[model samples]
Target chain A: MGARRQPGAGKVLRGLAMRRPLKEAGVLLVIALTATAASWALRPDRLPLRADPAFYRLELDAPLIDPGPALALYDEGQDLFVDTRPAPPGSLPTIPGAVPIRAASFDDDLLDLFDFLAPDDPVILFGDGNLVPVSNIAARLKERGYGNVRILRGGIKAWIKAQGPVTGTASGKEGS
Target chain B: MMRWLGLFCRLAVGGVFVFASWDKLLHPAAFAAAVDHYHLVPYPLLHPMAYALPLLELITGTALILGLCRRGAALIAGCLTVVFMIAIGSALIRGLDITCGCFHTDGGHAVGISLLVRDLVLLVMCWPPLWLADAGPRVPFLCKKD
Candidate 1:
């Protein structure tokens, strides 16, 4: 009965009672380090960070195009219509002849998709009426040197309302 | 009652750590991107952590689940949770729109209040083993196969 040991004191005392606190911690650290090393050596999909390249930044003040003009561009076939939705173009009724550049794979797929087009190609990107995702894709495209990148004002939903042609596996809603 | 609860806590904590490690281990690139989105870590160390963190999670989680070095595992788990909490908290404070990177390497759950509370609950679960007296039979949490 030298002194009363508080309930909370037991927690503090447990550290002293541990057989080898440093050794235990060291072992855990070693395990973590080893695993890290192994992952570095073994894992194939490790992406390293890099500085931004010399590409021009996309203008934040870029205006959104009306569905009428957007649909007209699609009709003319002079502009490239890009559906930035996560779904593949094949899965959804999209602007006819639109290429699916999924926002998920924005960096890689966008680059590949743009490789086939000219630097001056007028690319109209549309999503599920979400400004953030659609703007993000357009901005990235503009950054990569595309001068004419536009977001459809209300995305696919608006395109449908404007009686634009929507043809795919999910068709029959075009102009109806 | 305490013993049963501690066991449940151990399982819950350990199971979570293990499950969280799987996706990060398989897809380090996605994890690195998520980390980069945080903009906290220097660009150089990002990939290194992406690789190391999952392995640490795997080891501690397994150890905690098996009751091997339970105390040590619990401590490490608690520390990791704290680090995660701080990271999430900082991101929230800064209003950074980034993925939590807690479980999925891929962008599954966006960082927000719910994720922060989940981690806090996990930290609390790591507390019991730290304070309670080791009575009856005691098992060493480290370097003991038995």
Candidate 2:
């Protein structure tokens, strides 16, 4: 910063010269050019991890799996249901036995919530995909290393559309 | 070619930060969720930090591109990049699959070695200003690529 002097250009060049080592100059130049090259080497379309081509996204119109499969998984007891969506305003018909965890509540200290389930339980996540409180929660949970966790394709909207049951108390007498 | 390069890079980087901050302003709850996913900041202080940081990003990005406050904007960007690098590094270390939602993006906003490389590039941009400060009173951002 002493280089913050009047007639700043000369001092600045001096500063740069002092900073550059002759032996390292060629190496540094090559490195900088190589870095810029490497940036080009990697395309924007793929995830960097694993280099698995499957990770590359497909066409946006690729037909998504219907929610019937997810609903079957939930009904079969093969998948533990977790609702990552926000609770509706009043009594809402939620799939019975599905655990409703606010997506807002999932975070790094996931161990705090680990007690919610058995470690090895197969878990399927349902969210209101169009309103992403669900998928975001699932993504965060996946971040926490939940191996068997998955986001329900097209989310719960697909469920109701699949003829999956939504439980609401007729009298608002039963708690969902 | 260089001018186009400069213009594009400035727009891409500046646009990204501004876009990221917009969600924080509009959807405080979602923004809070995004920040909390990182788990670095404590829960109690998380909300304010979430609210302020994105707005800071937005202002700084706007300043950088508009050339209204170049040095300060660059510094803010550099600092945010460093913080993001740290946060992503922490997620990797902790074994989190967290997306780098600096902009509230939902798709796997991939993180890994690429993230480190990305930030380092932005960090290098900080050097131009320092060099320019020494050269003389100059424009906030160089359009050398432009």
Candidate 3:
């Protein structure tokens, strides 16, 4: 029987070197995917594989109305103003007659607010100073089929600066 | 000295990854919301990305700390850091006011120049492990014969 020829040392070393990183990457990916699957199966609070389409519908830069125009809307008494802060209604200053809707309690508040609001109602959402809450609540409102939602530019602080009528305490508290 | 530096870099980068993954792994929904603020990820991919990213961080971080595939773990960590820097840079350029979501999902630091600088520091830390051989002992059963 003829003896089989072995591969050269240089070639074997080259192959090993090339394959090592790819193999490491493969292992890394496998471990990650396996752990992700395990988390999904075991964790009660795991996220759904597919996100809600409502999130996609969220406007990255939702329309903004300045404090002056917002105040005018308030005077007209035809628009709905929502306080998107995470505090209790009377704890912080808010535009008078604005419906307090904390993002945490969005669903419950939306149910109550929806009863009085039509999908096409000119709704304005505001937060303390951070636009994150305002934009998020605006997106949620949009998801609920509220068509005319706009965030108040500069939030409640701007409203307070504009001398807009407010309910509860009117002190300009930051990050409420 | 170089070996010790490599070991330190590995642990530091890996520890950050492991630490950052904790809150994200536990609070997938909150992480999803945080990711949403970036507005870069597509809607359908958001949840899956949120789920997978943390697990990747956790496993890669563990591998790095254990000295099992240290180079590979460092590479992945480096790449993830680069991606994060890009995302943060994009957000800043776009003037999007969003939280960094680095450690805590809720009430985390806002995206700013400081966050970018921190990521740059992390990117620097990732290099030593990639270029230098690990000085630590191999993990039993998990590490292959080098």
Q: Candidate 2, fnat value?
A: 0.00
Order candidates by TM-score, high to low.
3, 1, 2
Grade the docking of candidate 1. acceptable
Indicate whether candidate 1 or candidate 3 has the larger lDDT.
3
Superposition TM-score, candidate 2 onto the true structure: 0.43
- Which residue pairs overlap in candidate 2's backbone? A93-A167, A143-B97, B2-B145, B3-B145, B3-B146
Interface RMSD of each: 3.8, 16.1, 1.5
Task: Give candidate 2's error at residue B145 in angstroms.
Answer: 22
What does candidate 2's lDDT look like per residue over A101-138, in tens digits? 67555552345457766656677766665434554565
| TM-score of decoy 3 | 0.59
Where does model 2 sit among the CAPRI classes? incorrect
- Which candidate achieves the best lDDT against the true structure? 3
lDDT of 3 by residue, A31-131 (tens): 89887888788875455688976644655446767677789889999988888888887887778788988878888988887667889988888887577
Error of 3 at B2 (Å): 1.1
> Which residue ranges in model 2 land beyond 4 Å of their true spot?
A1-176, B1-12, B133-146
Task: Give lDDT tens digits, candidate 1, residues A25-72.
Answer: 568879799867766666543344342211112233345676776878
